[model samples]
Target chain A: MKRFSWDEMMNRYPAFFAIILLVVALTINFILQPNMFARDTLNSNMRVFLPIILLSVGQAIVILGGGIDISVGGIVSIVNTILATQVGLNGSPEKMWTFVFVSIGAGILAGAINGFFIAFLRLQPIITTYATSFLYVGFALFILPNPGGGIPAEIANVYRNTTPLGLPLAFYVIGVVLLVWMYIRSTRYGNYLYAVGGNAEAAYETAVPVTWVLFSTYVASGFMSALAGIAITMLSGSGNAEIGVPMTLTSITAVVIGGTALSGGVGGVAGPVVGAITLGIIQNIISFSRIDTWWETFVKASIIVVALAAPGIINLLRRKKV
Target chain B: MRKFSISPPVAAILLAIVLFLLSGFLPNGYGSDINVAIAQATNIVRLAVFLGVIAAGQTLVIISGFEGIDLSAGSVVTLTAILTYVTVKGEDDKVLLALLISLVVGALIGFVNGLGITFLKISPFVMTLGMSGVVTGLIIIINHGNVSGKVAPIMTRLIARPLSPDIPIPNAIIIWIIFGFLMWLLLERSTFGKHLFAIGVNRVTAKLSGVNVTATNLAVYTLAGALAGFGGFLVVGNTGVVFIALGQPFLFPSIAAVAVGGTLLSGGKGSYWGTMAGAIVLTLITSLLTTMQMPDSVRRMVLGATLLVMISIYGRQRGFRQ
Candidate 1:
């Protein structure tokens, strides 16, 4: 058996840096907040972060499958608008359930549209998704001309306050998602995903279902985006046509910070999940640091740029040393 | 027959004509009057000129290959515009200094991005995306999230002044024509242009042929940044003011225009004139939508749909080429 070395381990396990980042950010946030792990405070932070975490998971999958889904945010927006408009604040539980299913359908439909074009028609993923993003957002705007109307406060409270086994509900949800992903990873389909992403022509030559794998990846992203939409809708207790606009870039950043290669076929969901939390923690650090409000956006962005460049910087330094 | 074959620019012109006629049948009949149509056409060209200038940079970056894209163009434009506003402070004397500063700042950001991509081996998309965030944040911090100041009168006069009552062409169009001509000459008539295209089509081939990929990539990104800064100056002249997010809407449209203009996101094939036509087509579409008095939602949906359709047409044609 080979003896463990720090460098080897980091090289083999891509999530290593993300875990380290998580620990560091947690420590800083803990020091600043002091209350640190109060049940309610932890729950609130997790609730707010759940949506992006979900989005990053979806984004990570698409990147791994050798595609990017800029339209995921638009999918989320469509779901949010649908829920907000169809199942109004006073809508019955049955209505809410119905719309939730419809929301999932909307997400899937949007994803399929993107997949149809990118995978089958051979359009560039970025442009196709960018165009669709506008379509989804426009549809959302059409559905709700303004940002108002939401699930009832009671429904929002359920998402905001829910805990199981004394852990935040988001943790359990994340656990379930991860478990499912692991199972999928063991399957042939998962292997196909990586193969297609690594090299589509080679994958095809080797009998991998390139088109299906590419198409399914987008469909999966859509499904996850739908879930993220529901989470964000509940978290905010409202809807806006623009709610998802800012999340797209953040999700992509999280994936990069999590050590996912944009070149594709070389990442996992867990890293991005952790990366998402790290990002949320960074935001908290800014707020708790109590620096000028104006500096918050700047500082956060600087940290991200540094984070994104870190892997490349490390590789360069290693090359130099050699 | 081959010489007269329908090119992307020709197709764009055809679409514009059809759309122009369709706009006449609009329920509200916004472009029906010959004088109004003429006036609207002038405005469309003005807007197209702004988009075209920015997109010219995008074309260079996109054509440089390696899955190249420049998402930071809009943010760079916004940042430079804000800086210009503050530096010029409505004074004629400071305009020259402000322009110099803007160009330098833009180039510096692009250099950092290029370094990240070339030396650090960062993906073009992520590098630019991260740079965009950093620039936006820097602007926000510098301006305390609230921008203030006026554009120089001389600058405004140069871009916005009407040429004649009957003709209605803005000086901006004239400037765009000169700039476009120079870009065309550089990209189509120069040795560097041919090599850049070669690099886009196949990096390995280009490298084997003695192309200096690293230096050229660096220069391309730097050029894109400088163009964005120049575009920033033009924006101030055209709008007479700057806002925190003045350049936000530009990011998508620039890419869209480039794509619609027949530039392959996969790189190695496209033209400046085609992109200019694409810009004009997009502006005309926007004007039609605005004239219809459709809600923002409808406008967005239509825009997205239009782009999707255009992409599908081009994508199919591209597939046959492969």
Candidate 2:
């Protein structure tokens, strides 16, 4: 019996299995529909996927630290509402920038409150985040009852029309996010996070600033969520309370499919990025296949289940030596 | 219990009562608006019944030492409802038959979940989540997202129409009480039930003592599925509809009942009675909110805040040693 490193075992787990499936999905799409690989289509899809990509990554951070955030979707909704109303209705472009700052600030503040309860007060992560999700989304609804508020044409143009060196601006945003994620991984806090999830008692034994590390990850997640929310405002040009409701489910699915272990120790940004794209493509697959509009939910749900389950089956096979 | 006397959920019930009374006396307070409160309460009870039913199974699953949070529960509910509707189809004589179908579906779904988590050794979170999505999707595919069929007239009369419609009792409430008692007996008094708690307290310990861990896991998920399936009956009875989205709402509240009732998310150590109490507390709080004329956002905010406060107080620690 060879002693297996956690990393080696993780690679064989269901989380990684799903990531492999995501790759196969994209490959199949390209092989079957060569046009689907066109830069224009890919760019547009990336734009739609950006918020989810950011959100999944942010959420994965918290989950990695042995916590989960149901509130990411709610936070995004809140920020989207604030931005749409402020940028579209009341603020000058300058004030809109201020609005963006304030809204993101609101997200951080809300997340910190979540952190306070989970980290300091010792509430279960699932319950704490679950309750906060409603709080944030309710606040969003309070601010913007309808999806009437709209971003300025210029902001919309940035998302819709802009490219840098022939690459979509959305991809550039991904690039930036990837850079930030890399920086996060480099921080001592990152190491502490991995430790916390892999073995909390051992980390505590080592005297890690466990609580603060936990606190900061949530704050970072909030920042990403708010950024995602603001970007959505520009892309959609309107803010609707219902706009991000689906993201809650989709983000977690994306994170899981990206090969981030639900157990919270292994996996990272690349897998989820691929995972989000595969999911975005799944919608396109349904439409292109001309599956009845009726079957869309069914098909998507099936895909989600299969994606979620495959990893576990793979890990089981590996573990059982069956 | 004289030794166990008061539970967190019991406290929450008392708190809801106090708040309800306070709301009645507040300046412009609307808690005294009885008819409206009852009407609104019917909806919550409708939901609470579905959640409480699922939580009953969750309590069992948790008590089996698996950290078995059934994310797939709502899916099971949806599956059962669709099966019931498609099979029963307003046939008063066949309602019992439809219910039987529901149990089979529950058992099958639970079997799949058990196979994955216990036999295959998949993590509870991932496997159940996959199962959840798959089941929900199955509902959509079966119904095509349409609200079809009629509840057997008697069921509609007995369950859906509520008590005079103007004074609705929500058949869901009736089912909740009857089943609640059934669950209490199964969990507290049965040899099988004792085995479940023993396993949940520690799988190794139970295994060492000759408890069949796999069988217990199977029983837990299967029962959970059955309860959730029954919940589907309550859901359709309450809403008189079956869309892809209907079952999603119950997911959070189902978990909320468990979490807010002092059940450790980690397996073992729980009280289903406490869960029912939590459900009541949730029902009363939401009912109290309805009496007040506030923005939807504000209502959600306050509703959420109440949940957080309840969980913070009741959910802080657990008896599950591990």
Candidate 3:
């Protein structure tokens, strides 16, 4: 039992929720068709899962560091616009790489601005991020008023065309991210992040650089946002102001699903990563179930309701035992 | 005089106006006409009043803590507005019925939000956000994505008329101020209000000290919902037509107003009066943006900056102490 709990551990983070959703997804896939687990289905499911998973991971890190970012979606919109308009600005592969750097740079710049205000200026994270969201999305609209800019044909084709042998290059990239995250979580620095978020005054008393950790978490979140934007650029084939519209809340949903406390600390990358997959599966199951598109937003929100209410239910049930 | 420390939010509002004037003084194009400037100010005040009414209710809900919020305020407006237009459909005699039904609808939704938060033990963030989505779905379903019908003509006359023609004050402002005074009395004086503040300050302590934690929370949320609904009635009069995304924009700004006005996000110490001031500050800032000849981006950037400054100043005053 201990080994089971330790190995596939984070799965137990949202134990009831993860199980319920998995059962639902599996039941839907089976009723729909037995071939639902095959290559094409897997590819499509993973594709939808990628953005949320990336966003959630970043969200988890920040929340673990005791803050929230309502600006992730706005950041994605800004970065996606950058990739759309400037992805191939230099025309050469080497120059195009520079453009990518600039896109990432934009993310860092945005994150840095957020950090300065929240960390140094002593602003509340949510309020600072909320205002910045208005600023960033408005700026994105200024840059690209409409969804007209097309990615290089080759870039769009990359996401569209699947490989028989490798499935998708995006898969490898995510796998690398997971491994790196796991490695980092084992480091002492990661331990400090938990301490900082859990109780900043205590951490400061113990000599942890609370300010730097708080600031860097946002920067780290920014990088993840940039990566997600790049992936979205490949998938959407064009840039629009609304592409990342749902991302902000979706990221939070994923993190909470992964069992990170909104009060901060007490979570890891595994929960957010799994939560993202769970969300993807839920979306896939919903799309395959003949629900209208209008109801889709409703369903996404219902999952949040269920996810939120379930914890309370559990806490209440355990109250009797206590 | 000692209490008048010159709040940063108020200062930000003043600065935005000054910037507006500097961009184009009274002798220039849009600013040349007194009636026009006053007219614009009235519209901004109208918007601010509606936002303040809902935000005042938001203050009570949040003061009970439990990760408390009432994001559904916006959706309440949407649902109530849709219902009013459908039921009244422009009749004067039936206006009271429409208003009563809307109040009931708002209260019912608020009751559900409170029940889920207190009884089910859901996080206020996710529960309210999910409810917002569900309410939004209801809005879409009822209206079929395009708003049709009209408010009662009597309501249009009584609720929409300006109280002061000299300043061209919106009738909504008059309604807002009267009700807001009632809210202040309820929150700052009543025993129910005392229980709410205690719970907000520390739910555990309040419960240990014999406060009916669940009841206070439930009542607060219910009050918030009804107030939001009533505000929607006023909104219908102001706009004279309903739009789908009408309530969507108010959610963040309401929260912003509460925070900027010096309400701690954690709850307990705040004023409905300050929230009213906060809303006016935000509206005045937005109005300044309009009077200035600057492009939309610059205008938005300034707005964002003003919000940040306001939040920071309040945080300082509250001694948020990272």
Listed per candidate, the RMSD to the true structure in angstroms reads: 2.1, 4.1, 3.3
lDDT of 1 by residue, B86-118 (tens): 888889999999889888888888888889888
How high is the lDDT of residue B31 in model 2? 54
TM-score (chain A only) for the predictions, listed in order: 0.97, 0.91, 0.88
Give the alpha carbon lDDT tens digit for every residue of B195-306 in model 2: 8888888889888999998888887888888877777876676666666666776777878877777777776787887788777667666655665677788888987898
Task: Report the lDDT tens digits of candidate 3 across residue range B1-322.
Answer: 5585675446546654665455346444345776666666566677788778778778777677756788899989978877888888788988889889888899999999998987885667767877998888777677776766887767866667776566456667778778877887898889998998999899899999999988888888888898888877767766778888877777888888888777777787777877887788777777666655667666766777767776766664222243
Docking class of 3: medium
Question: Which sections of candidate 2 miss by over 4 Å?
Answer: A1-19, A89-92, A315-322, B1-6, B23-50, B65-67, B145-148, B156-177, B238-244, B318-322
Against the hidden reference, what TM-scores do the models get? 0.96, 0.89, 0.91
Higher-lDDT candidate of 1 and 2: 1
lDDT of each residue in A50-74, candidate 1, tens digit only? 9999999999999999899999888
Fnat of candidates, each listed = 0.80, 0.62, 0.45
lDDT of 2 at B215: 87
lDDT of 2: 0.76
In candidate 3, stretches whose alpha carbon ends up further than 4 angstroms from where it belongs are A1-16, A88-92, A160-165, A292-296, A314-322, B1-4, B8-40, B164-169, B291-295, B317-322
Q: In CAPRI terms, where does candidate 2 land?
A: medium
Model 1 is docked with a DockQ of: 0.69
Candidate 1 — which residues are off by over 4 angstroms?
A1-7, B1-5, B27-35, B145-148, B164-167, B317-322
Best model number under TM-score: 1
